[model samples]
Target: MELTQRIKQRLREVEDWNVVRDELETEAASHADKSEQSRALYDLARACESVFLDKAHAMTCYQQAFKCDQSNLTALRHAREIYQEMAHLEMVARLMGLELARNTDASIQPSLSYDFGMAMLNQRKIDEAKSHLEAAQSLEPSNERYSDRFQEVLYDRGKWQLGLENVMVQLRALTGSDDPLGSDVVKRGHPLSALFLRAARILQQESPDDPKLLPCLFKSLDADPSNDEAGYLAETILGNGGHLQHVQKLQDRRIANTDAPEAKLALMLAAANVWHVRLNKPEMADYFYHQALDLAFNEAIVDVGWGSDWFLAAYRRLAQGADESGNADSLVPLAERGMSMLGEVDCSILALSAGELAWKKFKDVDTARRFFSRAAKLAPDHPQVVAFRRAEGLDDEAKTTKLPAMAPEAEVLTRELPVADDDDAVDVRVDETPRRSTFVDPASAAEPEPTRTPEVDAEPEASPEPEPEPEPEPEPEPELDVEVE
Candidate 1:
């Protein structure tokens, strides 16, 4: 192409710049003012620089252009863009600060605020980040992207050290966070039920009705089916073993899915608990108990507080079962293993329960008392231990008062009479005179005239003859008549 034609084409491409420049030049020449021409030249320069990808150069030109002509919208827009590109965020922030001060466009300020928030985020100024981000979000509520970013910042803030409420707030801001297996869901605390459910979901993918998942849910349900966290637990149990077997089929169809370690653990626990505590299937219980213990072993470091308890319980049960069946050798190692997992606090409770069980069921009072005493020492204020002590006292009292067995006749006599007076009652002598037993017709009886009865009455001879008595009443009547006269 010829040079002239190329120039023409270039000129045509920037027609707005040329036209504006020409008009400004004409006006300046007419007015004989160098300032207008200079300003026009600056505007032309800014227009040419707008094509440059170098944001810095474009920004400088735009600022110069605007100084020359304050009403330059192109310069204003280009300057804003360059301010946005300035990698020295502090400087970019200052420029935004200037824009905010001007308050030129209410709509643009919110966006500017959002950009500042992002800049703050890049600098890791969290408080400032949240402040600016929230301001931006408030102004432009329709911009979910900004809201999401703000919530993401909050989520990161609560990774470990922050309180659970803080973490949950951020989680709720994200959709579907209520579902454990949902993409944005984060487990902030020891929400065992949710954790179990998440594992179950993962397991479900492996085998729709994996028997593995059933036991996990069943144990939780049995322990407390009404627990909100255990909602899916029930479903998983049904899937694995309950009527429909729908989950099983789903799992069978997708058997290639991987088993989640957590889910497997949960399932094992559920199964073992049900088999041991519910169904009393020792073999089944042992199989899952060991599996659960193994899983707990892996999780101990991450979830030590509760995981340790679970592991210890499973190991203890398994060992006890083995020991009771004459497999003391196998039981020894398990007991040792569980003991290792036991923390001081938990050990106290376990010891106490063990002692009580031994005593109450087996009448090993000495052992039980030792256990109760240890438990009291472990938790002096524990209500249960205190109650146990009260019960122990009552039991002792009961034993002390236990009476000896008496002869059949004595037993019958003692039982027949309601105790009228405990102290007043006399113990019948072995060889006492025989007393005649008497009874009265309760309905037709009248009080007997107070009188002495003969010790022996043979046939009452004829109607009792009136007892002969001397009459001496006449003298007393004569003396009373004389006194009245």
Candidate 2:
């Protein structure tokens, strides 16, 4: 019998769903030797729930069909949509996690698994969430999102748990030295070396009460503060009862010793992020924000012809941080300064930020609209600007504008910007580009070091020196004697 006809016949024979369900089950079982045919029968049975006049019966059949072929993408997608609308949230997480696990590429797994783990986490299935996230992380060991979440799961247990300590030890071992974040030392070259440092930071958080670990953690941060690990570690230490004196002393030392503007920028940013998030010290956060802006401004002015992405990035971070903390007054000046630095460049993002700051933080929609208008003009096609314009119920009269890329001729214009007399004597050559070198692997046994090689013995050749004049030797002693007198 056709699958649809069979389901219809069962529906006619029994008013009770149990009888209808049992009849459908028998039909499905008869086709069990043909898995594909059985799956089709199950699907047809599940589909009957809509017309069968029983909602609960439909759900059970749908679930059973899904169980027969867990890899059925079509069934999974439809089920998700229904469950999401019905608010049947329990199974959604497990299904999403399983689907992501089926992906073959390891690089992409972490992002997918992270989403799955988060859903499970929200459902309060902590153990399952940790397992899925760990599996994702194992596939992509360097991914920050997976590793960070996995550590967070470990942290949900008590602070003194040995499991957390063991993870820390494992991370520290990968670092490859006594250094808290071993191979993560800046010497590693890749930006992601910071991952190890972040792992170390998580360890510090797990052992917040241990005074012995606090200094070591800070010491490790001192070595590679630019990475996210240092920022995260610093935040945890500052927030969770570590000595503030230690943080300040270490920061001060870093600021004094490192002449690299990028390093200073990283330190300032880390300080700002840490104080704002962890300490709830808005005033301190503002201080670091101001410092970071000042440093970024100097870099832009010094290298105006180059990319200002770093400075722009810093500004965005500061603005976002301020917005989150409800510090509107602090955001305005910073945003304005950023706008000025940006000049005729597409200043739309800044405008949107200003509008947000005004409307949300200061409760001034009129001022916000004006800023939004400018942003709309600057970037009419931008999604954020368009959204804001719509929110204000503004008409769509705005037109997109094109801006010029930084031309090479702008170098002369940039050079015209004033430089301080006391600034470092290092020559600012427009032609000289910054060096970016990759890490060289250490020598293997097959590649012996020069010191390890036997030196060839050869006769030494020497040249005789001419006789030295002695007359000037007496005059030095005579001058010293006269000074004593």
Candidate 3:
């Protein structure tokens, strides 16, 4: 990387600035190796910034140097410092983010994440900051800088009271978040649900009857219904405090606030689980399962992963419910419909349960065999299926059950989905993880039929009493005659 003689003479003493700049630009553009090109660009940037005083052009040159060779951290660092000195924090963050995107080094990742989170927080980009700061703190939990920064965000936003400061100290030990009680958290509620959940878990353990336990727990859930474990814990809380009604309100509020079908489905499954297991209202669980399918089925048809995950959850939960549910006559078909739509999954539990119910309850051997075969197709080596296969004396090579595929061309799903209006029940998705899928329809009449707003009749309405109309006519005639007189 020796300099050319002509450039070397200029380096010893600048005779003409233009000639030195031109030679450097030429070298940067024509260098065959990226490292050499980056080196040339770095030198060019330095000359432009120091001598020509072209900060903008110098910034571009440094960026280009970094682009040419990421190993040139000096170039990026220079660019970042220049932007920072000029009070362009956003640009500084952008450069930091680029470095992070490469995942070039694990050692500096926490620092970069912490710095990036701070920049975003300063910009009032709470959601973006939430992940990065949380990650930085998690990665370097011992680092007070990272931990304090993240906790500060939650506290400033949470606006906790003095009485709660001790609680906060305890919570920070358990988990570094407050009640997440601000309008800001209310709007997006990130870390809101996570924090609320942590608090709920703590309360459940220490003060199961605390008035705030269920609210905090449900709020945590409504923020992210993806976790499904609220069932048993909720049962415990509700059973102790009997604040089931409060949970109901939260569930309705969450359903009304969110429009994402997946979110709605999560709520539905949560409620269904609560009703099926805790409240022992199997009918209600059946209703919610139907509602969840109606809400999420079409989404499953279209979405690749997330919405479909919710659908599968509702399906599997309903299928599990079907075993003990008094409304199995109706619930089983709804679960089957979801299984058919999913086409195939790694787990066959739903299909296996469906087969068991079909044989033991419905007494339909053929349909039961079909379901069993489908279950076998999903997991040919599953122990349960193997044991069942041996008992049934089925062939080793059972033909795969090919249920009707959720046809991509199936009638554009116009199903009226309808979660709750004014009910006061908390629905906690059971442990399958407020696990994610999107799922549909029941075969039995026990399923509540979709409500239809019938078209209004065009015919004029008749008087409740025709005789009353005649009396009014007589009275009007008598009044008219009196006026004429």
lDDT of each: 0.40, 0.47, 0.51
**Each model's TM-score, in the order given?**
0.27, 0.34, 0.33
Cα lDDT for residue 149, candidate 2? 64
| Best-to-worst ranking by TM-score | 2, 3, 1
Query: Model 3 reaches what TM-score against the true structure?
Result: 0.33
List the pairs of residues colliding in candidate 2: 175-182, 175-183, 198-229
Per-residue CA lDDT of model 3 for 298-324, tens digit only, reads 343323222223343344445556544
Winner on TM-score (1 vs 3) = 3
Task: Name the runs in model 2 displaced over 4 angstroms.
Answer: 1-109, 112-130, 141-208, 242-260, 301-342, 345-485
Q: After superposing candidate 3, which stretches have Cα over 4 Å from the reference? A: 1-242, 266-294, 301-317, 345-349, 376-485
Mark the 10 consecutive residues where model 3 has the least summed lDDT. 476-485
Candidate 1 local Cα displacement, residue 447, angstroms:
99
Model 1 clash pairs are 207-251, 208-247, 208-250, 208-251, 209-247, 209-248, 215-270, 215-271, 216-267
